[model samples]
Target chain A: MTADISLTPPDPKDFLDTDSLFDEEERLLRDTVRDFVRKEILPNIADWWEQGVFPVELAKTMGDMGLLGMHLEGYGCAGTSGTAYGLACLELEAGDSGIRSFVSVQGSLAMFPIWKFGSEEQKQEWLPRMAAGEVIGCFGLTEPDSGSDPASMRTHARRDGSDWIINGSKMWITNGNLAQVAIIWARTDEGINGFIVPTDTPGFEAHEIKHKASLRASVTSELSLDDVRVPDAYRLPGVSSMRGPLSCLNEARYGIAWGVVGAARACFEAALDYSLERQQFGKPIGSFQLTQRKLVEMMIAVNRGMLVAHHLGRRKDAGTLTPHQISFGKMDNTRNALEVARTARGILGGNGITLEYPVFRHMANLETVYTYEGTNEIHTLIMGQALTGIEAFS
Target chain B: MQVVVCVKQIPDPSGTYTLDPETHFLVRPDEQVLDDTDRYGVEMGLQIAQAHGGSVTLVSMGPKGSMQGIRQALAMGADRAVVVDDADLKGSDALTTAQVLAAAIQRTGFDLVITGTESTDGYSGVVPQMLAELLDVPALTYATEVEARDGKVTINRQTSAGYDVVEASLPAVVSVTAGVVEPRYPTFKGIMDAKKKEVEELTASDLGVDTSLRQRVTAVEPAPEREAGVKIEDDGEAHLKVVELLQQKKVI
Candidate 1:
């Protein structure tokens, strides 16, 4: 005979014990990143957001924590499991998307290209310091007119003896203002080639983009490469064409898929707290059926987004994750997070529009996250192409 | 020099707790974390070891399945850990805890022992002294700043007034109070490295120590509820009423 055993109820925050999917090490690492974000970022983020300044000093601290290039192997990188890195992204993004963007640009965009396709000399020179946050790097791929179509980028590199001279501008570059070196992808006589251009080069200038309503805490810049010259040693001797930049985008897009979950969770938690403390009709607003339904929706969306992120992270670790799947996660999770943030903002009523609560800030930040990496429309097309075998982009 | 830190894995203080009517013991929550008080001790031990060319070994006693606290301390840069876990050791008093810890520390062999002056859960504030007596070492309590040099340890011991500069020979036990030093958060590398670090588990029988309880709780009751404060309505003499209440409480 089997005796009756009582099952414990699910935690509303974790609801499904999604944490059980990770091992102890992953959880501990996640907690470490969470604590770091809580202690370092959360308290000061509002002021930073208001000032439109991302402290360049924190790059060193994050590098010290081994968060920079944390998923990559060798060169003083942490080489942690992909799931752990994604968990770190979740926690960091929970503080603010700008902080998470800082890490994503540093690790996936800037450092990843060097680690993946750079020469031994380049890797030896940059990876260790970049991983330690001593040197900051930014990717120069998106041009003023070229957002979705990198093949249409006007930045061109021409051979001058053994050296290559580049001329063009890249817009909306994260970490551009502070980058010591920039990985500028320019179309060459051969194909698209990536050049590691030092910022101190005579023709390299970065102008900070101002008046951003969303992602205000992040540094967005317009890079002018006016006859920037670099030696052949600086060119990444890897695959030519769009593959190099596309792979790096895939890496960052995967992180974005996980990062926005944190933004959504932050808004949901703020709304939940406000609902409980806010009183109307002689009781807390949370007592109402409509409010509870919104809460449940946010809770389900956050948890579902987390599960998708975890599943993709596991596949990435197993070396089986496909690009279309990443696009799927990025599109779905970003859309869901935006929806959750909007719903949470509605739940907060008048207070939602204010910066006093994180709801509005997260909602605003999710607006940018929705547009960057790959827009929801672009990702949908990627999914559509994968499903129906039709190349739709003109 | 070898510094061994005594850590306790207490139920997370932030979580709710309940009392067992049958046993008169506070039932532990499912979540366990390192005692906040003991962090200073562990940090001090790590600092001493880093400066003096040694390592910090963590020693803890808890239920058989609890390793979260020890793992956390290890992640904070402790070299290794020795945990004494056994079901038979339940309901062990302060003296019995001292015995089990003394036995385990003897095996670990420490040149210095560090612990919190008092645990957050058990406020007896007597374990360090008892452990020192059992180990036949001098006990220094309430250390806010610690320094080890020339085969000796020096501490700024907190007292009724300010603090006292106390010096003791090596092989002594030091109980650190909070705010000695800011504890460092574990880096990602440290967390991964902690998984590979050695954690030697032992039982009370393995330690060959007495597991007998020396004290029993005769009664258990909830703390008395505090009385509500007097509310003075403003009648253009609110300041005078506040002054009178303060005077009544001897605050002015």
Candidate 2:
């Protein structure tokens, strides 16, 4: 006896029916961001990647849409729930990881510190405009030698009469070249103090970094602060230790925990569609067992990563989320997303190497995402420390 | 002016949809999205309400899950919403749907009622007229442009030839086509605000409307697959073959 069998195409990336987990409003917020990405980012992303330039004007568009600092309250911010903000990150990263990074740097790194620790006068001066996207902002903390160990930063600030003079440099800063304000963290007599310095201040300069293989569509730059003097009032008075900057990094890392799932899902979808259409050996490549195994693995990783991100997001919204929980999610999701992207790239064969397919672009972007906002190794250590009552990094 | 817009929840047209083999009703997926055509009607209602200094209320009837579509309209700037979801309303025909909607509208009290030309799935094109008859108001169909002033409404209605300008008093029913106005995407702020917006739910008993099915579908069949056409090679006799095929079909 002979048997006949046929293979069916895979469904969308939401194999677990994840939409049921969110309320209608959360889903609507996600759909709105998804539509914006489909219309604005997806069409021009490949070209923007090829040219190695970020569209500076989209800041105004995003501001008009109330995406900047959307989770913050008052000062023209949307004051949405943290879960809604995570959904926005997921949708933004679905288009490209570079877009999500720009928003993360602006909202979490730059605006978050000011919102959380800045004095009322400083808030009145900058929060509304930053939320409006009329003024751009960047966070300067990582120096050339300080990637993970920010406590060893060489940047220093000294008191000069009524003014404070800051001198140092920051590397691998997103939105640096386009920012109008820089939140510079420097060592002071008290401790690590953060100063909100205007980028146009005398002796302040930012140069765009060239020849980047990852995150090419984003503006990454090196910031130079040479005797940049500002009034003492520009210093954030509420925070006096490295905890100030580390808190901001936690916020951005939380967003990244949700963002990488989007990148992985996009790559998996691209590979799945290509495999079903591209024929080989008198049948679709999807008919092969090896291709099916790769696709299934990619799908599971994307779905599981989203579940972790969503759980963490809800916890954050409920005000019960811990930094170590965020670290666990960030570590698992980014590593799994990078694996999914790499496996999907393999399924695409030679086509995966070209920009015509999104797998390669996302794979390259995940490398940067894997390292920034606390590296995979750093998060693993954090989890290790949480599990055991001992610190690993001496 | 108080504007009431009619919205419907339909299966995603982009996905594969089928009719129930036994009941002949649409097999709905777990998630039912708002119809694309209704978005234009909601946008038009919002624009008119904004200009005339009034509130826009959305009215819809479907399964309990249909509240998703109503919430989407509310997120797009509607003031509030009323959804009629009851098990007895299943498999309702166009006229029955109109009756339920008419009852719901009477409860809401509207100066102007707007609706899409047709639902994407049903495509009946008769609900607006039936609704106007039940509400005892003038019905303007296929409106491409709408304006309201001095308790009167003017609309440019699309027709086969071109468009015809029509005027009606306040308390009228107007059906807008898909391209009547560009719909705005709900901003993040709008989506958050919608969570606080009020959504009133009712059932068929509350509306006091009989939802007995008047039209029944006995069977459903898939559309016939189109056969591939024969390709004529570019030989010396290609023109002759084309003429012969056309002549055989009595075309010329």
Task: State the DockQ of every prediction.
Answer: 0.69, 0.57
Tens digits of per-residue lDDT, candidate 2, B1-252, equal 999999998887868888888899998765687898999999999999999899999999888573566667788899998889888988999988999999999999999999999999998899999999999999988999999778898999999999999999988999999889988777778777786998888999999998778889988878899999999998799999999999999998
> A259-348 in candidate 1: lDDT tens per residue?
999999998889888899999999999999999999999999999999999999999999999999999999999999999999999999
| Model 2 lDDT tens row, A170-204 | 99999999999999999999999999999999999
Candidate 1: tens digits of C-alpha lDDT, residues B1-252: 899999998887766767778777767754477888888888888888898799899999887354777778998899999999887887889999999999999999999999998888878889999999999998888998888889888999999999999999989999998999988777778888997999999999999988877788878777899999899999999999999989999999
Interface RMSD, candidates in the order listed: 1.1, 1.3
Model 2 pairs in collision: none
Residue B167 displacement in candidate 2 (angstroms)? 4.6
Native-referenced TM-scores of chain A, all candidate models: 0.98, 0.97
In candidate 2, the second chain superimposes onto the true chain B with a TM-score of 0.92
